[model samples]
Target: MFTGIVEELGEIVSVEPHGEAARLAVRGKVVTSDAKHGDSIAVNGVCLTVVDVEDEVFTVDVMRETLNRSSLKSAQAGARVNLERAVRADQRLGGHIVQGHVDGTAALLSREPGELWDDVRFSLPRELNRYVAEKGSIAVDGISLTVTSVDEDSFGVSLIPTTLELTTLGARRQGDLVNLEVDVIAKYVEKLVVTK
Candidate 1:
């Protein structure tokens, strides 16, 4: 499990494509400080296991399913990614509970700048739209943010100066794809209600 709080802005050092999967070497000093083989790390909101860790860089294998579901399918060697180590059992939940399992990818639709913040809107997938609600928590690129508004096809989030400076969302432009993970609790609730 993860708190959805970004710990570092890491860079993809390399991407080696195999037949049905890809191996990524990411440079993240803090996340790799104590990381070992089999440890889980959130790369851009997608949870991946550590295959190797060396010299502040960690390697992970991305399966075909993950590639098709996330923006990582088009990830390049120099792309920046949000990194977060899995939450320790004793640590505080800084953000909401995030599984690092991205449901789908969305594109930045628009951005409106505020004096000290920016209100950003992103296209919402039809199936995921029902899970998003105003004031609810969502994970975009692994950084937990609250939904400011929700419509049929898109949603908005207000980003403070800290979020703008700390995460990948700050540099994202219109049409850029980002990974999104709706609240897990909401999904579970829907499942139960539907089966009743």
Candidate 2:
């Protein structure tokens, strides 16, 4: 339910552990400006519901499943995370549809920099190789990007200056872990074809 366009780079305020969950507080200006209890927000590619709201800060309860599937487990105070609110009906679809449901995490294999751009290669789960395609859409850390190329074991995406400055990807280095969500449409198509 998000466009994958980052609204703001929010910082983690705190991470507190509960029985089988963790409570995360984030400080964001744009996303929290109109956020209320029960609103959905994407933090580092994971969609979480708002349980509490204060000025420039909102709290969300991260269940065990979310922690296991996404990058939130390693999240700490002051960590810069990409934030995006649910897409509105009248707004333009600037980025592809991102459900905030991360399929798995990928490791940054390498980064090649250019004068004003960069290409980052990532090693994804081998099982997901079937879903990724060249020129297809992929969501990394809640930012929508196109697959510049795909190989048997990995993929690469070119990041422009705007993407570098607006999201957490700018801070990533080799061996860094990032949450990834593949195109939902591709998954559905594959499912139908397999059932035939």
Candidate 3:
């Protein structure tokens, strides 16, 4: 599991296609400091296993399912990605629990710049809308953020100066696609309620 706290802004070194799947080489010094084969890492909100680690770079294989579900399908060399290592049992849960399993991809609908922050709205998928609630936690591109507002077709979040400076959300523009993972708790609650 991850806490949706970004550890570093990594760069993609290369993307090699293998039939429907692909192999990615990413350069992340911090995340690869102690990483080894089989270790899990969150890349832009999608969990991927480490296939190899060398010279501060790690390689991972992306399956077709992940490609179809996330923005990673269009990932290219030189792109920046949020990186996070799986949480250790003794570490604090600074952010909300995040599985790094992106539910879907959403596009930035608008951005309203403020003196100290940016209020951004993103188009919400119809199926995922029910899981989002105002003030609830959500993971966007592996960074934990609280929803400021929610509606039938879109949701909003306020990005503070730190968030704007640290994550990919700061540079995103209207029509840019991002991976989103709704709160796992909400999904569980829905499943239980529906079964009753």
Alpha carbon lDDT of each predicted model: 0.97, 0.94, 0.96
Candidate 2 lDDT, 44-66, residue by residue in tens: 98999999989799999999999
Per-residue alpha-carbon lDDT of candidate 3 for residues 1-196, written as tens digits (9 for 90 to 100):
9999899999999999999999999999999999999999999999999999999999999999999999999999999999999999999999999998999999999999999999999999999999999999999999999999999999999999988998899899999999999999999999999999
What is candidate 2's TM-score against the reference? 0.98
Q: Could you give candidate 1's per-residue lDDT for residues 1-196 as a string of tens digits?
A: 9999999999999999998899999999999999999999999999999999999999999999999999999999999999999999999999999998999999999999999999999999999999999999999999999999999999999999988998899999999999999999999999999999
Give the TM-score of each candidate.
0.99, 0.98, 0.99
Candidate 3 error regions (>4 Å): none
In order, how many clashes per candidate?
Answer: 0, 0, 0
Error of 3 at 15 (Å): 0.3
**Residue 33: error of model 1 in Å?**
0.5
Off by over 4 Å in 1: none
lDDT score, residue 121, model 1?
A: 97
Query: Lowest-scoring 10 consecutive residues by lDDT in candidate 1?
Result: 161-170
Q: Sort every candidate by lDDT, greatest first.
A: 1, 3, 2
